[model samples]
Target: MSGSLLDLVKALPTDPSWGPPTTTETMLNGVPYAAFSKGDKLGRMADWTTEGKDREGRGGRQQYNQRYRDQIYGAGPALQTVFNIEGQNEENTFSLVDNSRTTIRTRGFGRGGGTVFRGRGQRGGPTQRGGRGTFQRVGGRGGQQGYDNRGGRGGRGGRRFGWKDYDKPQRNREASVQPKDSWKVVEEIDFSRLTKLNLETGDGEDIDDYGFLYYYDRSFDKQPGAPTSVKKLNVLERAAYNITTSNDPVIQELAERDEATIFATDNILSMLMCAPRSVYSWDLVITRHNNKIYIDKREGSSLDMVTVNENAADAPLEISEGNKDSINSPAQLMMEATHINNVFPLQTVIESDTAKREMPHEHPFYNASEETDPPASKAYKYRRFDLSLEADPEPLHLIVRTELDAVVKNNISGEDQFLTIKALNEFDNRAQGSGGALDWRTKLASQRGAVVATEMKNNSCKLARWTVQSILAKADLMKLGFVSRANPKTSNDHIILGVLGYKPREFAVQMNLNLNNGWAIVRTFVDMVMKEPDGKYVLVKDPNKPTIRLYNVPKDTFEEDEGDGIGMSVVGEDGEE
Candidate 1:
């Protein structure tokens, strides 16, 4: 028998088809085949107890087998086709529901490391957990408390613990004027788009000048926040007017003569130009007649009111929004600020009929025969700016009614220098919406630069508007008064800290205010109105969004309100009511 086996082996080696199998013959029946290394460990072909053993934390054979499967076979495309089967099997249908908690390691302070064990129904995925009490679980129970990094219990709303300021109530301000059903939406513009526009206009030329200016009181320019410099803010009764574009007699006269294609007051124009920096809502009425556009504000519009910290991160809250402090409310603060601005300029000027600088024409809006009180120190200059482009067939022009508050004689040149006066009021630094302002009483003297910078940040919109107005009027100097409350709790009493003077153009450069961008904004709006037919339009900033909307309405839109005297108040020549 041994002799017969040796003969058969010798015969197999000699035969071509029966010798050791060639590399090309790698299939058995219809199954693909591949060679495996002898050192690789083989896993069980069928394990029905894996799910039960894995529940007891002893089995995860599939995961372990997969890790080595790639290492042993190299996981290349050529080998993958030879090893993997195409048809479905029992392994594909098998499913294991894992109820076991997961253990995750996080970088911990001092020690080997930290381990965070997740409960079965925890929502968040595996992530690092640090700090003493930082484990947070969600969606398990309704009122269960969780620990936060700040060592405080989480609220029922699932809010993470931190500073209590995160709990600030939402601000839901009402629109300046609600849209009526009869109004049709014309265009909607975002502030972001307005910021990119730029159109350079020439230094405006004075079309006509009216009213007179009182000489500024140099005493207020002393060291601000000093005990000697502080003065009580008094309520002065003077005839000041803030007439709209169409109502002004000079603008009407100019419009009749076809002086310019557009007309707006300095206040209304500045607001529209600085629309990108504003946070609060305001509306302007644009009446398009023939080919002219007139920008006007509503009678009792918030545009006339000076806002307190309107650009602050935590702006003054309304009383209806659960704010306990009524003095710090937005409405009360606006009223206080408006009162200060109205009376501040009046007080800062030396009121003498002889030492005043009278314009070419008499006071446009003030009437001594009809009024008992003397008119406030104000001068209106109707300036014409060229807004024409080279591509246009006709030159476009804009006439803006600009105002000056006081006049000062230049000591060097012996020439009269015009000035625009505005006041910045401080409520309370410790208040909720103080915008991280310094204590004006204590720091204004020592750190005036820091205080002014803080005010610039907190009141960017207000300051920008003032700067724009000062530049619009071509004032030689812009006077900013730092006024603070006599007591933090009292809104009625205030004291002037000091007055800081700045040249309008230089101040505009410092504030990074681009007049070209403002002109571009004006021209863009003018073009929009010019394209539409003769009608009444309203341009309104959205209350809760960074957007402005243009609406087309009937001619008698705000007429009823004006006739009834419901929401209209006459603003004086000093731009105050």
Candidate 2:
């Protein structure tokens, strides 16, 4: 029953857990999906949103987007990369660390508080006879002339009353979520235009082989020393063609109240790239419209369009042939094929001090998707990057610069930033571009030299070591069994890995501090994640990346909580033991 690495990875979450209290109000076919304001007809709560349908479409494969309620919007957690450093170079001999630590001082009991009694002598000044103060002598009845006081009518007095002690009301700390400036809009928007008359396309969602969900705006590229913005989600739209009668309660209420907080989500899908394989110059614009992005990809040469119409069959012509879209993709298409290559397991060039490390056909880093930090190494170089268009200010470009520097400096912390792996493949570093658009590919080629230099400097660092210790206590062994193996795969780099490039953009959220419209960028691209004898994630070159632990969450995910004692690397030779 000993815990396995695969066991922990298998416990990760694939999708996010979302529900109410934190969920946003939404509507699909007039049905409510989440809590929404009742005052605004459109539920315009500053950052709130709703969706619409494309009632102006001709037929299947048209650019028509029918609004629907997929799911209520929960405040999705911000995306981040965790950085961690591991201790290595434990010496030629095995350096075993004792798991048991001695606590100098135990933590538990403490002196409790006592009542400040003042009764009689201890509290209240000796209680007055009867109640508090029942009597107060009135000098002489009414001070009329001496004669008027025949015999002071027994002086009368006002009655006394008591009040209860009060204290201030307390506040619930967990319920206090402030407004967020960032939002993410994931669109499987697919476009493929055949001609001015014919079109064919599909949703990127169902397409398995290739698809992209990048931010139109560079908003999360805040790098080291650059201004960074907080990132968050912005859309809650679904296919209205599939919605039920009552929309999400919150969205319906907001829209009914004439209140809305929608912005343009610039996502456009068309058959512009449809001509059997020909490229089509396409344009589309989408504003944040009630949590969902109100796309305006309507043009003369376009197919269908989503408009503000309650009817699904007939609506205003939002898309036309020549309508210019504010956020449209330029006419371009790369070589593409209809068939996808078969999926196969990746083979690693396992390293060994003496014995070859064998993986149980388990994915690299336990999960091919999860990015666990590599320990420091004598060398380290990341050739490619996955730049976000969401980094605001400083430009996605600036963010890329500063962040890369921070990574080298081992300073991956604070806002919109997390440690992520560009490539899990220990493959050679000579591979070319992989995903995204022209800008991304170009950035990859441009930053290759710079990324290498940065990696080289760190890899050559004299101060670096990694120490990994896995053990089972007496109780743990009785229940979970013993640590059966000591397997670690190190990277080798004598072979050619994939190529890399860098392109930075703005933060996913707008940064108030940044004056630039977009974030700076840096990109790294490759045909594959290389696995050589030299690049096996040795601890010598790993820098200040955060430790992202694998939790037992039943989904493939990363937990911010640092465990496994990773990312605690030492620099130079004579460092901590």
Candidate 3:
């Protein structure tokens, strides 16, 4: 029997509705706010950051900060900005700035060969029988007299021993851990002070509180081409520059390590207006002692004081459990430590494009009869820079060291310098065409080293761009002598973006190079300084001054020019070679 009964009713059309706006936008902590899909906030906080205002100490601001504190703790979206020639004017798009690139792109496939995580012991099955039975006996004669030879029979054997009852030798297992001395004196180092302090003011005077020190007893001679009227810094201004640029001995030691192979590049040292809010260090170690108190080991390089015990080791002090997670050692504790080590407090901008571009070049015709050669694309620029104060450099330096080691092993040429532009170009080309699989040589660099490097380079670019956007930001720097009026009248006019007023100090910028395996060249002690203020640090100007200086002693002792002018150098054919 087939029976089908259905009640079908049609309803009238209704007006389109979004259903009460799935989430109503509340003012970010009581101030008018607008959240963009890109994770950027257009609100009072961003406005206050750009303009001059006291963000801390005030009741509402403090409460507002505490309420939305989670914003800074997570990895925020990658910072990106576009620099293009505006329709209004294409001629002066990148004026008063240096254009150069440093690139490192390596491709391969495989997981990184680092320590892996495994549970300490095996899962449960059956408990092994415990007794000193050196050897399992088969029958009644070999069995002990008092014990049951058969199943539950104390005397003569009713049955022989079974295979199920035998116990195998238990293997003793241990994990590969750092020697006790590595963490013996667990000290709680306070790294909170390591971050930029009193950053709001941006005045030279506020720098003293953060333990910024200079390289005393060392004289840095001004290069010959430096501007005539160098902005003679005030006492506090000089001190501030001294401290920020001051060389840290620990950083120096790390760079000089026998394993380290630095390749000095053109764009290693450059300046930015604002620093990233937080510096992360995965290598930081923390430990728990019998007292239940935690200890921390500061791993990355920042200009912070390190305390040591009388024994000359890091002095351990008590820390809160919250901080225990920032430590790196004791693999068992790694998962727990991730929480504290992952805070991002401020959105960091990192441009993915390394500005690695190709310039078209045609072979010059020596004879009239020769056919015109087609234009070829040649590698023009590549940059590798990162803003990580602590953890970033370790991976970067390590990658360079490994790359150099490979060149040495291959020994393509009799020279020590094996890393070359050709090899780097090949890497960049291969990386562009390949998917994201890291081989042994590139595994570590891919996961951390390259990422950190790119972030730093991108952030520096962002900071420079932001500096010009806000007059208040430039004003603060001007008050501190970082930005000066070119003619004292132009000070009220448009500001120059990259005119750095201060001479650069302690920057650990190094690169390794092997151009055609000629010589394994190591260029170290490179720092980026602004073009010496042509008659003091000027903000505004008639004709713009040179912006950047790529300061480094080349591997060749014979080269006369040590610091190349970034802005002065022209790019195309008729320009400086």
Candidate 4:
């Protein structure tokens, strides 16, 4: 038998195709032919269950093992058949659905270093089991425990309870004037776009100066917020006017003579220039008639009111938003601040007609017969800034009616320095929306810098607007009075804590305010209006978003209200209202 086996092996070697085939043909019919070494050990021809189990359990390594199995059996085509069978089989198509709850054991550092099971508990709520670091349930229904890493119902890793957190109520301020269906949206410019604009303008030329300024009281400049320095904010019955752009007599005369293409009051113009810094909503009425643009505000506009903590992260909340403190509410605080500003300037100056600085023109809005009280210490300077680009055929100018509050005698030059006085009021520092301000009554003496810095941060928009107005009017100094409420719970009375003075240009530098950017913003809006036809356009700042939209409307849009005498009466050049 051994001799016969030896003869058969010799015969297999003698035959040319008896040994391992060396043919280069890759496929025998439709099956892929895989070349394998003679030393390779062959496994089972087809083990579908094990292959499937390996693939589901071992992932990529199982796939590698399957490939190795395929090479051993030369069954790559058979594996494709098995895949096709599994895909087409109706039995395989139907999956067993487990109705009962499932517990998924995941690798986690649990209690006693065991695996954690995340599953539904007996109380019909999701629970994390077997871990000290397991999520604690909170605010679940029916005594059901729900997984919460932060031990709260909201979510994991939310803002902590603080002034700038979700605990603070949301402020949803209404627009100064809502848009009508008739109004057509012309352009929408974002605050981001306005910030990038820059255009250098020349120092405006003074067209005419109106009104007179009383000499500033030097005694109020003593140590602010001190017992000796604090004074009651008195209500002054002075004729102070905030006339709109189109209603101003001087601007009307300038428009007829074509002195400038654009006209705006310092109030309206400053708001537009400092729009990017503003957090609240405001609207400007832009009337284009006979190639002239007038920027005006609506009757009973919020722009007329001074805001409190407007730029704060957590600004004053409205009473509707669960704020029970009516005195500290946004509307009341605004009224308090506005009243203080109107009276603070008048109180800070000595109303002496003999020692006052009189303008070239008399007070434009003050009347001798119709008004009972004396005129406020105010100076209206109609200044014209050159907004002309090099490409323009004619010089484009903007005439802004800027105001000065008081006049101070310069100690060094002995010249009278013009001043623009604005007040920053403080409510309860412990109250909500205080913007982390210091106690001005105590800190204003030694930590005055810190108090002022806090005011600058919280009241950035208001301060920026005041600075812009001062710079536009060419005022030498900007006086900021620190006013606080007499009682935290009452808005009826206020006390002047202190008066801080700053040079307009220097303050602009510290605030990083770019007048060139403001001029560019003005020019951009001017160009937008210039391109459109003669009509009434409203530039509205979005109440919630940082955007300003320009809408075109009919000429008679706001005329009904104006006809009702809702706005300030038009004052003539002869000081007749």
Candidate 5:
């Protein structure tokens, strides 16, 4: 506490990286002490001997208070009684020394005319032992009274701010209901209007065909009026501009009434372009059945991709152009022609009775070590989502599908194969209807709107993202198998189904024809291919009615098959060749 140690102070280095002084132990007068310094710079020193005495005094005072409780509240006994106390209390209070003082307590009108303190340890002189109000107790200070500096009956306790509030929070009151929060009001959208707009295809493909389904999210920016010109506009920019320029009264009214900020590179650009933001997108599923195509649509939000700070609405928004494929692939020009757009491969689906009846262990690819058995035998069928499961009796899917030419390559053969793929698309149906898996999501969009400023306590996207990712990761194209009949009007007409088992590639085999239903039952197997006379591997084709083409032998072999059993043949029943 003296300046005499000034000469002992070390000169500070000019290096800016070095910080304040640190403490170390040293001996002072044959007793341990704490010296805070950097090098020779003396900052502070505390004698261990004096520290122990200070601790003892605090313990003595606390003991005195407890022993004489109920006599004068915080007031303790005489100094002699304090020194006579025994061992320290179990819990330490970080008290250094025992100092006694008196505090004057004056009653003030609090809420409901209840008593409150005017000041703590103010306007009072020290008193002897056993005196009332000797130690000042901290509480609400005097401002206007009623615990919150309010005078009138209307005042409860200032205002009850949220935990996130920067101002002082008012004391809890039982009489008041919770305050209304404005941030809870999410932006409103008219989903129906969006559905009418022709969706933009990123790859410039004409998707405005008859069987295409379209969905629009209402969360996108909707500016009023038309732009003066149109240049340097993004995809969303162009669309928003067109919408604003529309003569439609509804569109004009929406544009004119918005009180929010409008930004653009030029007067010609659209509001969405000037202030870039993620727009609402949809998942489109196209189905082609019996040569006719059908489409289903569902709405999804891209708001999460645009991080908003609700705390500061006017703050510059941080945009994260997340994996565009997962958001809206068709809208991105590059993804339109890729196989990544298709989530399902219909051609690979196996359609055989054997698959339905046999076990996974019995399949040809059943390698217990590799676990690469066929999906059908393993019960790994593609998943289908049905909205009817929620309430509608009919099923619905949020899955999206697009057509692309996928390239298949063989590593060992160095052969590249290009195949047309009509499969599932990356964009999936999410936030469908209003219940079950999408319940929380619908509620969040309803409350938080399209832009969220802060992190929500309950994350609703986890489930939706999982659903989409699972469908993408687990879907694939598997080979198909089928069983068929060769001919009718004959007994013992047992014929092997389409393509024999994957193994044993010889052409010589027995045939059976059961045409009871005009076509025999077809049992399919994976890797079932045929080797023609020219040695080319090809899929087994369906047999034509009235005739069957046998391979790898002379034309007259069918007439003389009973000899070698290695050539083509056409025989009636009774095991005759």
Candidate 6:
């Protein structure tokens, strides 16, 4: 390396948008640890989130540590922006790389712990033999069988037993009787063998086990806990996507390949945000063009100033917000996207008929034989989002407002459609308790104590502002789950009979139910409109009478800590985004 003033540099663009660098070091379990604390090292793994599930035997905790849905979902802050959804991609099953990971080692506890043999205990308590002495009372000389006795010191404390001294002291002094190692230290990294999806949905919907999180990821953002920023997708009516680049090899490679930036807004901020993962410590990768290095990031000593030195590295390929002209005016960009839909890895550019109206162009990038099937056009709601042609482009979103009358009318007769989803089951990784399937595997409803409503704003032109009518008519419904303990020391130990914390989640299927064709919707309305919810609760399931139970886990209790929450984070606060 050169003895230049700028020894380390950053490759990611800070201007567009990067997630705010994270400093809080903790597992998805809220267990805190230093990011680089050597004491917390678990071999080659440096920043691994957790080991596996341990929520049963050890007081509701499992022998292993596992990542929470939010932890996995939050990992793709950058990916969230470019992708359709964010959350555990568990069922989708994939690896960061194209091929399955090459290593796997799964070690689990044997079943002997739970089995018991009848007729006798493992060993009778204690036995006494050989020359046992008897004691006699001595008052005056010949009162009664007078005798004094002393017995051997109660044999060896052989095989001491009980929960406390569960296992007796063995021969080896160096051997440990109590285990202090967390299962984390022995966790196996089987490459990509196991199936688990860690993602956050860009759209508001809880993952359904049947095929939830099957959606591919295309975005990555770095920011958390700020005014929420959403993922960006090309609508059926939009042409062209955005990409940002820097001189660093990693950054350039990612942009060149259209990999979503970990810092989501990189397409917007120009050079202000920070990327999450980095190759080295201290500083991030900066530019390497023209033989000079630009300022990479805040240094330890002086977190503020930049010292621009001579031909130290290469002057950044003269890139900065002040320069770089490939970006067209927002007006030009917007005008260009009136229509066009595309997928990746294409040598030829495919433009739709709608795109031709906004920006006419002959198909110059492809051979006629290479064109694939055209995508069907979906309805574009410019009127809903309140996008204005007169305003300059900015980072703010223009929330769309749809008219209730138009919405209802469109629902009944319009051709445009939206995606809808309903929950059928939940996936439990802990597999706690007994009864193979029910112990840790069951699909139950999860949501309630929430509200969903639409708000309308008045604008003189009616198009100036708008209203957002929630797809669902009412919210705060109910759902169920297994596992009762509120804060078990171990999640795996939380073995139980049934679902504990039951709540209602706002489950909506974007694909509208053809109201005219479905009578169930009509029936639900009868109950809703008449405030007779219980009138339809008791349904005949063959003939057996089943009892209904209502209970709440202490305040912040969860079902399986892995997915334990009032509502899976996918459904927002109050089950409304």
- Per-model C-alpha RMSD: 13.5, 42.2, 39.0, 15.0, 32.6, 39.2
As for candidate 4, its clashing pairs are none
**Candidate 5 wrong stretches, greater than 4 Å:** 1-60, 66-399, 402-577
Q: What is candidate 3's lDDT per residue for 1-577, written digit by digit as tens?
A: 1221111101212233632222234245654332223222444343244232233335565566555532422122221111121222556565666444434443211232122112233434343223333122223342432322232323333454434524522222221112232222211222232122321211111100111111111011122113432332111100001111102222233344432222221111111122111111112111112211111112221112111110111111123212232221122122211111111000011112242121232111112253243111111111122211243334222101000000111136443211111100001112211112223123322353452233234223322222221121112121001112233222121111111111111111211111111111111111111112111110110111212112122123212332321111112221111
lDDT of 5: 0.22
Once fitted onto the true fold, the runs of candidate 2 whose alpha carbons sit more than 4 angstroms away are: 1-262, 266-280, 285-293, 296-332, 335-577
lDDT for each residue of candidate 5 in 1-577, tens digit (9 for 90 to 100): 3332322333323344676543332446654333434444432343333323243345564554444432322212332233333223322536657666445554443434444333333444342122233332233332233323342332344554444646533322121111123212111223232223232111111111111111111111122111211111111100001111122232223235431111111111111111111122211112222222222111121211222111121221112322223222212211221221111122222234432222122322223474332221121111122111244343322212211122233347845322222211111123111011212222223433221212211112221222222222232221111111122221112221111111111100111111111100100100011111222111111111111111122223223322321122112122221
Candidate 2 local lDDT, 197-231, one digit each (tens):
22111111110111111111222222311223222
The top-ranked prediction according to TM-score is 1
lDDT string, candidate 6, 302-412, tens digits: 111111110111111111222232222222221221111121101011333432211122221222364343322111111111111234253211111111110111235
lDDT of 4 by residue, 1-577 (tens): 3443224333442334555654444466865445433333666456555544241255575665555543435334444555456446856778888746455544433222332234453333444345444544333233333445643443223333653465655667788788999999999999999999999899989989998889999988988878998898877666667778787878889899988889998999999999999988999999988888889998777888888899887787888888878988888888778777777888898977589898899888777998777777889999999998999999988899999998989999999999999998888999988999999888899998898888889989999999999999999999889888898888777888888899999999988899999989988998999999998999999998899999998888877776432243332222223
Error of 6 at 43 (Å): 57
Off by over 4 Å in 3: 1-251, 258-462, 465-577
Better of 3 and 6 by TM-score: 6
Ranking by TM-score: 1, 4, 5, 2, 6, 3
lDDT of 1 by residue, 1-577 (tens): 3453224333432334543443433367877555332233554354444333233355367566434433324223454644544423545887878856776544332222223333333335565344434565444334434554554534544444447777777787889999999999999999889999999888989889999999999999899878899998877778777677777778889999999999999999999999999998999999999888899988778888999888887788888888789989988889889888888999999989788998899988766787778888889998999999999999999999999999998989989999999999988899878888998888889999999888888888888899999988999999999888889898767899899999878877877889899999989988999999999999989999999999999998988766332222343443345
After superposition, the stretches of candidate 1 with alpha carbons farther than 4 Å from their true spots are: 1-162, 563-577
lDDT of each: 0.80, 0.19, 0.20, 0.79, 0.22, 0.20
TM-score of 3: 0.14
| Comparing 1 and 4 on TM-score, the stronger one | 1
Whole-model alpha-carbon lDDT for candidate 6: 0.20
Q: Which candidate comes out best when scored by lDDT? A: 1
TM-score-better candidate, 2 vs 3: 2
lDDT for 563 (candidate 5): 32
Superposed by TM-score, candidate 3 places the C-alpha of residue 51 at a distance from the truth, in angstroms, of 65
Give the clash count for each candidate: 6, 201, 29, 0, 28, 100
